[model samples]
Target: MGTTSNSSLRSAGSITDVAGIEVGHFTDTRRPTGCSVVIVRDAAVAGVDVRGAAPGTRETDLLSPTNLVDRVHAVLLAGGSAWGLDAAGGVMRWLEAQGVGMEVGLAKLPLVPAAVLFDLFLGDSTIRPDAAAGYAACEAASVHAPAQGCVGAGAGAAIGKVFGIDRAMKGGIGTASVTVDGVTVGALVACNALGDVIDPDTGRVIAGSRTPDGKSLFDTRRSLLRGEAPKPLITGTNTTIGVVATDAVITKAQATRVATMSHDGLARSINPVHTMSDGDTMFALGTGKSGKTLGMMTLGTMAAEVTAMAVVRAIRAARGVTAGGLYLPAVSDL
Candidate 1:
């Protein structure tokens, strides 16, 4: 929704439309965990923001504007909590083989920043994503919209844990993109929140904790404000990670600002987000391949919108997960 000469309000439908971007997902259903790799054939300036108190991240320090690294080769979002961080190593291995990344004396160290969401509780906690899983994701990379919903890092994703796992809803990966005035902005999100997912346009709950009967929806915010019985919380079991890509030419600092503003999209679509137990993080990447037709302010605003839409898409596209006698239904199932 920026000032575009084209005046069209539609996108090419996925992040790949941004050009030079490829998305890949490697899902290990046996472990009920996987990783998603966002590959940029051409180096792209990157920035990140970690809002949650508990986060498992790798190579984030290098993303700083003051850091020597100006661009990133890929970003990995995976399941398996802290142990899943190993997946990043696999991505690095693949990139190095392809001759991508900052060149060192004898080797090119691929700069891949990664974040993990807790999904151990959803499947076999003992089986976690590892280096092999990361390499598989890179090998599976494609230029089209990656598979969404209960696949990739979202495989074990679950939402509305405020009332415990029994009442939680299925969470997964989703994507949305918009092209305006020849500038395209897109977002891909792995939604696994500790609160309810809302439809911002309608202001109605789409998914969240349910009553004991698993029939009526429970309002997590109202219950907290009313001082009802304290809901049990499983610390370090939730988080949401995502990426925002644009063709606009922007600096690392500006990319950081875009990441900051994009959090507004999470707030708009999720109630009671960024809690202590969640490790919510987002990354902003700029390809700088297109002319700067829109101001930074306009691009930032549109990024937020794209992110919010991606959140809604995540919930809508999610598929039910059932393993070890635990059943979590996607929004459509309900």
Candidate 2:
């Protein structure tokens, strides 16, 4: 197998191999909500898949097998609980103004794919990232690496909630990339797992459940074995969404396979993932830049490894904050 480890490439910025893809965020710290936009190459081939039992997806039809041949211009990741779906409307408006969508007769429509995760339960339900925020995020996109952690869609993200906010830890967005046979495959994830994040290689808990006293969160297996029912709390509404971008040419089917492989990264970095509480999802985009040829399965596996690394980075980049006299650790401290 090709080497999947990326410990040697440590820098506080986006991966260098995945070129032409830009990221931007519009955050609302006062309200604990925000949105992000990931702009692939001006026109790239893209595909998507949603495996979570409960997911909030938008513009999925654009990734259908028939739609795969067309070029995908952009993707939007937003916050507002389920209500955040409106953010896409703003993106559409901007794209339409730029003539970035599908063509119909004499008119050119913008084809922007988007996805969303829930964050309303974190703060004031009344406040959310509106259409204006979506436009702002898109306007901020550039070639440089974008900010991570409690910025963008991850602004209100939290984890380790089998016992509510008392045990939840700070979670946010992260990214990683790798070169395979001269082809670059990169991944970015917004982590909000129900369980804690573990460093699989070291057997250490990097992030996850926390104590009310602001200490490391630990396994609660012993408490469960005692025949006590798990805490009946509203802590299961979490999800992790990501995108896998590659320069290699691939079909929609291949893109879907890459997405499935990316989930492997999630399983490695997060404990008890794909659970009813977590709505984990992944997307794949082909930039059509690399000339190398490879099997779909091979790319899938590599995508998974990169995805896992990105998720860990997201956790490690979080920043701890205090709320209601309680201190919450951010990914940066992990």
**Least accurate stretch of 10 residues (summed lDDT) in model 1?**
1-10
| lDDT, model 1, position 234 | 70
Candidate 2, residue 196: the lDDT equals 74
The TM-score of predicted model 1 comes to 0.95
Off by over 4 Å in 2: 1-16, 66-70, 220-228, 233-236, 323-327, 331-334
Q: Write the per-residue lDDT of candidate 2 for residues 1-334, one digit (tens) a residue.
A: 1123444333333533566687778888676678887776466777787766667777777787776445677777777766777777777777678777677778766667777777766657788888888888878877576677788887777776655666778888877777656667887788877767767567566777755565656554333456635456553377888888887887777777787788888888887677776778888888777766667766886688778888788877778765445456764554
How does each model score on lDDT? 0.85, 0.72
Model 2 / residue 325 / CA error / Å: 7.0
Candidate with top lDDT is: 1
Question: What lDDT tens digits, residue by residue, belong to model 1 across residues 189-232?
Answer: 89889988888778788999888898777878787788856466
> In model 2, which range of ten residues has the least summed lDDT?
1-10
